[model samples]
Target: MTLETKSLSKMDFVYWTSLVSGGVAGLVVDIVLFPIDTIKTRLQSERGFIRSGGFRGIYKGLAPAAAGSAPTAALFFCTYDGLKSYLGQFCSKTQQPYVHMISAASAEIVACLIRVPVEIAKQRRQVISLRYSTSLEIWLHALKTEGIRRGLYRGFGTTVMREVPFSFIQFPLWEYFKQNWTAVTGTALTPFTVAICGAIAGGIAAGLTTPLDVAKTRIMLADENVSKLGVSRILHGIYRDQGIKGVFAGFVPRVLWITLGGAIFFGFYDLTARLLSSDQAK
Candidate 1:
């Protein structure tokens, strides 16, 4: 008996092409929506009422978010490509993932993986305090104080909780949407169509995960003694203080952000995936 690494190894034209396209999609979304994302995140995570602000206020963390996500995006697509291919090969046609959805979902998981560290840095960057001046500086401070895991990767658990299911639901949904839509319309599934699916999926995921997301934010950003506090207690505290509406605090902004970016990010991602695979075949 012998072991074969290449046999186990996964890399192909479809994967590279999808990855390239997905990577493009990621870059476009972040660049276009960086401002909105920064603000939505801030509003979502902040306490004592959501502060209304101009585009500048909302996008305060754009610089670092952009910085963080540039590398993050590349890694996201690459990981997504590999994971989707592996998953697709093993899973059935219905359960198995396609390149498009896998790309979207994998990109998101990648986003989730780095989210905490980047988020902590982003949060610190926005606040004008003695602690953090920039992403780099904030990182240094976080490294010294809370150490790597606790400070940088604050919301590690919830990140997975949100990303995996969110990606799973979304990727397949998009692929289904593209297939059904293309068949009915007898036209290629355009970028716009893909965007619509991505947006819908993003909203659904966001709505479902907001409570956990809120907890993640509070734990990371809040000064509270996170250890003594349970997620339920914190959520109840929010409900008591701000009411049920407060739980869905950043819903509106988040929906818009996801909608706009999802369209652009995923629309291009699919298109690019097609191109990449074609190039690989050549």
Candidate 2:
């Protein structure tokens, strides 16, 4: 069913639809592009762009990512759309950009709770030369040795820092593109247009935030005995050690991954949401 745009209540069906659509989109995108993600992670890891492995075990941590992708994306879009609808009542159209920024940042915070642990597992598995057999094994081993907070949720704060600004920049830009596309073309924004906008937004966001991502990855992958380092310290260390380029270690692979992944993700999300709404109307 088509969602009534005027509805601001949390109980509205659109919120749930957004969750389902976002989840399905995320699942599809992560699964299809997971190998690229593996490569990107390896590039970003301490290995520093070395040829770790060819296509031998590219799908190492696909399970944990597949498990978490849906829920994380679902929570993100659900919170985003819900907040936008709720805030729309009080804010003028001129303030919609701020609303989008707030909604995206808030959504990322909630999504990170699920995302960080899965990411820790996924990245560790990706970097390892030896196969872990299953994502469960990696998680269990990490939990047993490093414990939950230090092991699984090690870079939670840095991740949030990376993600919040990423979303803040991305969603507003995505929305702006969508609005302008409609205004300029005098046609409704299609799934293709949404995908294009999402790609542009995701690529820019991912590129600009690579330094924070590098910090987050290093923190998460660090040995437990290593002293804890904040984002600033990690970034400074990267700069001091490898110069300016070290901070953007995985920029190329990451940009490629996020750009294509974002296109596929928002494409499917918009398509699924539109189909669901159409079916409901019928």
Candidate 3:
């Protein structure tokens, strides 16, 4: 292979490997500690968080959270890798990094398109069954009661708005930080450092996109399925009722979980993939 092609292959090898590893780790986290994710989603929805009925309420939807999240994580990384390859055709030899960024962002956007709907169902089931049973049961109930089209896919448009830019900024930023930060520290990329960078990127992206997320949650939970609720109306309602803070409810857990979880995902994935690819290239 030519030098440029070799380099691109190396980077792509790392990139794809990191993402896939991260997906598996994410699945592990979602399944093992699903209550945290369920609570995070339920709190984001604000349908009933503070009341917390009890431990039962908090852990209401564990099973479905796993089912929904594990597969989505797998699909997300897979789609991201495929799209990056497809988009690579248009990238100049000199702009591989730029192309990488674009590919990662676009992959996330497409993944979000699918994710929002499943997440709506996942979150709704988590919220409604707060007083009841397992996440798996909730999943089946949601499937039965709400069906595929309306219930599961409640906030798809708004979800797109929230996730697209979030991924756009997050993935590239983490990679940039990982390489540079390692160089600066004169050590290999540690999980803690990677986690810190991922956290920073994730926190910024999550905060930046909170307004859209707020609208998405509302649309998902609305009795009428408020896809009709324009972005302006959603913002206006939150502003009028809850004010600016209302628009950003649950910022704490959202930031912390995403950052910590993101660190584990990206750091381990990158380290493992780079090692595997280096051996393969040899």
Candidate 4:
């Protein structure tokens, strides 16, 4: 049996396209829904939902998140697309879904390297009383005080626990929905369709992972005392203190943020890809 092979160089277009598109999509999503995310973080914080300063500083950490969103998203899609393309050469059509899953997982892991530090800065800034003016200041202070591993990447494990499964649940579901939507409607999958599918997948994934998210948030934003506690211990504390509902604090806003953000991220990504490819063809 002969397998058709194309030059890997052909994928250069996909690499650049995914990078640019993912960046744009991520930036838009992060900036637009930043307020919701602020609220969610506040809800998940150890301080509970009654922090001072009111809604005035809802966009407090928007800078770091917005700045990081582009690069993080670009890295994820670029890695995901590259891996998927490479894997496709070896895997049969029947095995494509598994390949996608593996690719997405790989992408998420790599993306986390960039994402974790950004999250550390963002979450810490969010819970504070706006003492720091910029994400850079927050990061520098944390680095000086807490050191790298403990400071900038405090919740790395918990974040991975939340995000990896989120990718696992989200990407496959998005693919499945897109395929089925195309089959049923007899129409090509458009950005709108991709957005809808992404929204559903993201919402489900975010909702399911809320407990892990709460754990991650607590770990990242924890003070010296709480920071000493292990993830299991912290989770046990949440359960012990506030019950099951506490474990899922900020579920509604998280779902809303992720769902809408997913829609915008995916929709813009697809739209950008289509436009880029069209330009290349012309």
Residue 276 lDDT, candidate 2, scale 0-100: 83
TM-score of 2: 0.92
Candidate 1's C-alpha runs over 4 A off are 1-10, 49-56, 97-111, 127-131
Best by TM-score: 4
Worst 10 residues of 1 by lDDT: 47-56
For all the candidates, what are their Cα RMSDs to the real structure? Answer: 4.1, 2.9, 4.1, 2.6
- Lowest summed-lDDT stretch of 10 residues in model 2? 1-10
CA error at residue 46 for candidate 4, angstroms = 0.4
List lDDT for all candidates, in order.
0.65, 0.85, 0.65, 0.88
lDDT (10s digit) by residue, model 3, range 1-282: 899998788667655674566567666666655566656666656455744332355555455555556556656776666666667678775665676567676666666655765565466656653433544454466567777555556666677677777787787777677768967888776656777787788777777787777677777766654556777798888789888887876676666667666766665555655666777779
lDDT comparing candidate 4 with the true structure: 0.88
* Clashing residue pairs, backbone N/CA/C < 3 A, model 1: 17-276, 39-58, 195-263
Give me candidate 3's TM-score against the actual structure.
0.78
- Residue 125 in candidate 2, Cα distance off native in Å: 0.8
TM-score of each: 0.81, 0.92, 0.78, 0.94
- Tell me model 1's lDDT, rounded to 2 decimals: 0.65
What is the alpha-carbon lDDT for the whole of candidate 3? Answer: 0.65
Residue-wise lDDT of candidate 1 within 1-282, one digit each (tens)?
A: 234654443365545565567567766777787766656556655543334233445455567676666556667767776776667667687765555566665566667666668877776555433245567877787678777776677666666656666676666766677768877777766667777777777766666666766666666666525623666787788889888776767677667777677777777877777666566558
Misplaced by over 4 Å in model 3 are 1-20, 46-48, 51-56, 85-98, 128-147, 190-192, 225-227, 274-282
* Clashes by residue pair, model 2: 1-280
